[model samples]
Target chain A: MPIDRDDARRVAHLARIRVDEEDLPALASEFNAILGFIEQLREVDVRDVEPMTSVTPMRLKRREDRIAGGGIAEKVLANAPDAREGYFVVPKVVE
Target chain B: MDGLNSLSISEARDRLRVGEITSMELTQACLAAVEEAAALNAVVHPTPDLAHEQAKAADARLAAGQAPAMCGIPVGIKDLFCTEGVPSQAASGILAGFKPAYESTVTSRLFEAGAVMTGKLNMDEFAMGSSTETSVYGNTVNPWKSGDTELTPGGSSGGSAAAVAADLCLGATGTDTGGSIRQPAAFTGITGVKPTYGRVSRWGIIAFASSLDQAGPMTKSVRDAAIMLEAMSGHDPKDSTSADIPVPNFEGILTGEVRGKTVGIPKEYRMEGMPEAIDELWASGRSMLEDAGATLVDISLPHTKVALPAYYVVAPAEASSNLARYDGVRYGHRATLAQGDDITAMYERTRAEGFGDEVKRRVMIGTYVLSAGFYDAYYNHARKVRALIKKDFEDVFAEGVDAILTPATPSAAFPLGQKFDDPVQMYLNDVFTVTVNLAGLPGISVPAGLDPDGLPLGLQLIGKPWEEGELLDFALAIEDRAGFVAKPKRWW
Candidate 1:
């Protein structure tokens, strides 16, 4: 559970945020503070607490689940920076 | 047209129905006011031509004796909702040029009801942050408070709140996952309501947290909120989670019939640093309700202390998953690496350059909580706390309390960037407001009075499921007695 420089860097990289070398220390500190606060929750004894998913105790409504094929290919592709042929085109993955 | 800008939604609708004024004049007034307040940065996207076309159609319908429920009112669609041609971004760098192909059920329903879309108002990135300062588009200044100082129009929905408060638009659509609508409304001295979870459709709302997010009305008056909510609510086949319950005639429910109604005053909402002025004002609000023939009861929502923590976990976890679509290949502001580019690098680079610091911080926390080793420890535990918080409300409601009263926020609103360095303090902004979102219940923030610093404070009202009409009715009664001016005096 320790957040060293490498862990912070890897996390920053995974999150796609550019944390400069100096900023890494600050980000790490913040992460630690958040973790410290979260750790406090461990002290609470909720042995019998049921995991509540919503405020109202109503169950999730079910319907005949089916797919619409997104119904709007061009619409989905519209926001794609380099979209083509009713699809989002990205650089090839492997050689 | 009789100062259409000053009229409530009910008045406007009645006038339109009786042929007192055409839809064209009203829509034009809204558009003109938006133009006049261009300096407030309240509008992110404007479609004057489309709005004029829609208004003409509305007028034509009136001439032909066939008008939809909300005839010809110009409403500012919060940019968070996906409109057909109008671009929708959750006000983040990640989805700069994104436009949704499908319309959100709420937006589509309003359009169906004969409301004109003025344009998309600005918001905080992914509905994060209290001040709209986090938006990629610059901060939304409080349109009511005119000056070069650029005060904090409390946010995530600051733009919509500001627009409505300044009469840029008669009303605006606001989405509150956690305090997005109410906080901003309180700051701008307008009435903002966050309806029960399923009361409105979340389909195509550009998700923040799927479960907690719901859209509602931000308007100048309670009756306006009601009319707008009726038009916005209903069953949407597209959004299965949407409530199938019939939308009530919200205007029909606001008869000030709150005699003998029970309003709960939860002791937990009195946070440690809460201003004494808010404490006294809260007392005054309760007394006014009592004098109006409602019983004020002291209640305890014991689990309220845990609401902020549960909200932080649930909202971010969902946000992380939802925002994963912005990984370069899917949409918007792609960061292209030089040759030898791999897929992992592509995603990393794209997201790195796209999201702001606040978003990245959230994503990291979200990922951490939903990670393989931590899912149960963080996300599941938060769910347990979430249930407890819900139970607390249920217990109070079961004991004859019709609604809960508390301060909408810990303080009115601090200066912009006051708590930027401390994320915890920034998160604290939602201490009073987040519980409602956590519980998926209806809540509203009506401006009460100023704090010691002369900043506006809000009296929040929390209601049980599908009880928005009743809650708004009570709040509006309070407003009539409180004599709250819909527009702040200093508002430009």
Candidate 2:
């Protein structure tokens, strides 16, 4: 579970955040600190406690399963740096 | 003066109804103010032509005898929201060039109500910092202090708060995940409200912990808060989480009488190393309620200690999942690699270069908490603690307490980089405000008074999920009695 410079480098690659080699040490250190914090939770007694997904303690409201969405597609896509064919245009992934 | 920049939403509506101040004039005044405050660095992108074009249409509607409550009001949309045609980045490199073809429902609703968006205000990238310092664009400085270089307006909705506080815009939209809206409002000494989650649709607002993300209005007055909330709240078919309750007259219900309300003064909020002025200001705020015929009741939110840690766990965990879409292929800045580069390498290179250290720190924390070996230990347990925190509020509310009051932040806005060194300490700035978010309740931060350093101290009010009416009434009553008038000198 320990994250070294290599692991941090991999994470940086995954997250699309550009971190230089010099910065990888700091990122690794930060990752270790976070892992250390997570380790502290190991001491808590939570065997019987139920995981809470929401605070309201209410059942999820049920709606009839149906496709109903409203909003202009042009208005939605207006912020995209590149858009074509009514979808976000990205570099060709498949040759 | 164009009514849009200076007039309250109600006044603006009245003018629109009677044809007094034209929407175009109002929109122009806001554009002019944005130009004047360019040095404030409040607005990241100004869409003056778009705003004016919208304003012209609104004016035509009014001239044709159409009456919209928000007709002609120029507002600032925090850059976190995606505005079609305008760039929508979460103020981070990963989302740098990513634009949503869709408008966030909240801002679009505001536009539908005739509020012209003047520009996109700056925010901490992905709403991830207390000081707005995490913004890739740049850190936002407070408008309250005149000529002080390092004074922060607060974050990650710092620019939204600054624009409203500096009178650059009539009202600005803010999204609160963990104290983003109210903390910035407090720092700027403005009136900002974070409605109960789902009260406003999050359909178009960029996600920041889906459960906690909410779009609210930051205005200069409580009345404006009401009018704006009415315009902002509604059931959006796009946002499945959007509430279906009918929006209330937030303005009309301001009877300003807190006669029978039992306000809770939680003891746990008073911690060690707390300042004397904060106690004095809190006491003064309480006394104001007592004078207004409300009883000050002592309450115990016993699990208050766990709110911050739980929030740190839950928010970041969700953030890790929510932010995963920003790989190089779909949207945002793509770090360069050779042709036929593996997809995984592209993601790694792009994310590593795209996010800043604080953001990286958060993503790391988020990933760690949700990772295979730690999910049950970290995220699951924190969620249980979250339940306890919610129970504390429920028990107190069941005991006849209408609202709870606490200092919005542990301290007034600290030096620019004061808490940056210690990330945990920086996260603790959200301690007082996070519980409300955890409880899925409504809370607001009103400027209470000044600390010893003359920085603004804000008092937070926690209310029942749907009882903002009672809460705002109580806040206004206290605001009246406290006579806390510390306006920003930069404005004058």
Candidate 3:
């Protein structure tokens, strides 16, 4: 389906990426082109085929749920744009 | 022989053992080369002090006769691989000042094997674009060129390819997600291998599409690729998907013998509008493999046409989910917020300002596909088709095809900005390469021959899963038969 300007706006919002009002049409057209190209996938008969999540046939490796490797708070917050008293400081949502 | 930086990894290892050349000398030579080729914009972070320190350590190990094969070798680490305390931006604006406190598994393994790091190389933003033009550092120029037109080093591993081709480093690490490594290697006239999906650990490499991303080596020769790959690969407990298989001695077992191996030539890859040079190169590749006592069989990967579209859907869908972690809170470039702005506004502004156009397009597409209304039709359907694509490879390999041979790319390196305007045109660059990623198989692009414009073209050899040893051996055969010794003219 061809994506409209509203659809592009919705997608950008859903993606949490702010697209300018001017760029929405361009984004919509690009999405439409990609969706149009991807429409070709409907031609293949995928009846009874299982969706492949990974190339290998292995379950997610599980281990004992314990704190295995996270002690250095300084290292963890080394690249943080905003940190306060060894904790990441984000905008206050509850306020 | 020509210079310490020009020697292949194996040759450097030999010289290091025989006391002919020290690791410090080789690392210094590569550092000098990196300085001389600054115009190429290959090495993004030239860690001279760290490299010299590692080289000295390697020399000490070699003196004690305890050095591994990669001991003292100077290799360029792709920026995708996070080096502890070094900036590991996936060449994106959002990751502008982000530095990881932990090292990636692959680079850590390379470091453990005594490989000296020259610096982090440039790549496409989040390893998305094929031209490396989307990088914040700017487009890495292909060392090869026509009269005066500068060409692009195919990306997102463009910097890796350029550095190796220009002799800036002995070898460099590259991550292949939908032909990032192979296409760049072909463009720069070097050898690159994309190991099977689970071959290399992806612990610290910035995630692009977790299922499609695999790290490999870009080198001057297949033998060098083998040595580098061996050092870079092994199962890591951290990466749950990393294959728990024994790492084979890839360089030692390269006898260049492909006798009794059935090489498959897929009819589906013979796409229309393919340049005559690529076709000729493919034909010659078939002949060369046949001459190596391998039987060439016509095979069919019937679902090949849908691979690209499916890959686009799947890769972006996963990328959207993976990149969600890059919000303003934890790390990376956080957008300055206005008064009374909440977390959601911060996320929107941060992502809007951080990601490039191509990345935004992908994330939007990914979100659209995974949205409530279109999830089953787009993302789920694409995943099912991806299974069929994998089945197509499985069927051919089940029929005893040891490896599949095809053209690595549709054409040689194009001039920069020629295809930048059209994203579809740029996406076509990975047409011949994306199928391997979809099927989760190992693929290598070896410099086959030159095109009419005197640019290098590459032939791809796709191997069965977890069979990179055989894949590299067959690539060595092609490298031997093709005898591709041409290097890009030192324009930089």
lDDT of each: 0.82, 0.81, 0.92
State the weakest 10-residue window (summed lDDT) of model 2 chain A.
A36-45
In TM-score terms, which candidate is top? 3
Put down candidate 1 lDDT per residue, A16-55, tens digits, no spaces.
5557788888778877877666664565566799987555
True contacts kept of each: 0.55, 0.38, 0.91
Q: In model 1, which residue pairs have backbone atoms overlapping below 3 Å? A: A16-B352, B144-B491
Interface RMSD of each: 2.2, 3.3, 1.1
lDDT of 3 by residue, A61-94 (tens): 7779888877899888878899999889998878
Decreasing DockQ order of the candidates: 3, 1, 2
lDDT per residue as tens, model 2, B1-492: 333576666667787788777888877877887887876788988899899899888888788776567777889999999887788887887787666776788888888988898999988889998888888888877877634646778899999998887777889999899999999998888878888877888887778799888888898777788889888998876777777889898888887699988999999999898878888888988888889999998999987777777788898888888888767655677778778766666777777778777877777777767777778778888888877778789899998899998888877777777777777777778878888888889998888788877778889999988898888998888778767767676542
The CAPRI class of candidate 2 is acceptable
DockQ (C-alpha based) per candidate is 0.57, 0.38, 0.84
Q: Tell me the spans in candidate 3 whose CA falls farther than 4 Å from its real position.
A: none
Worst 10 residues of 3 chain B by lDDT: B1-10
Ordered from best to worst lDDT, the candidate numbers read 3, 1, 2
Instruction: Give per-model CA RMSD.
Output: 2.2, 3.0, 1.0
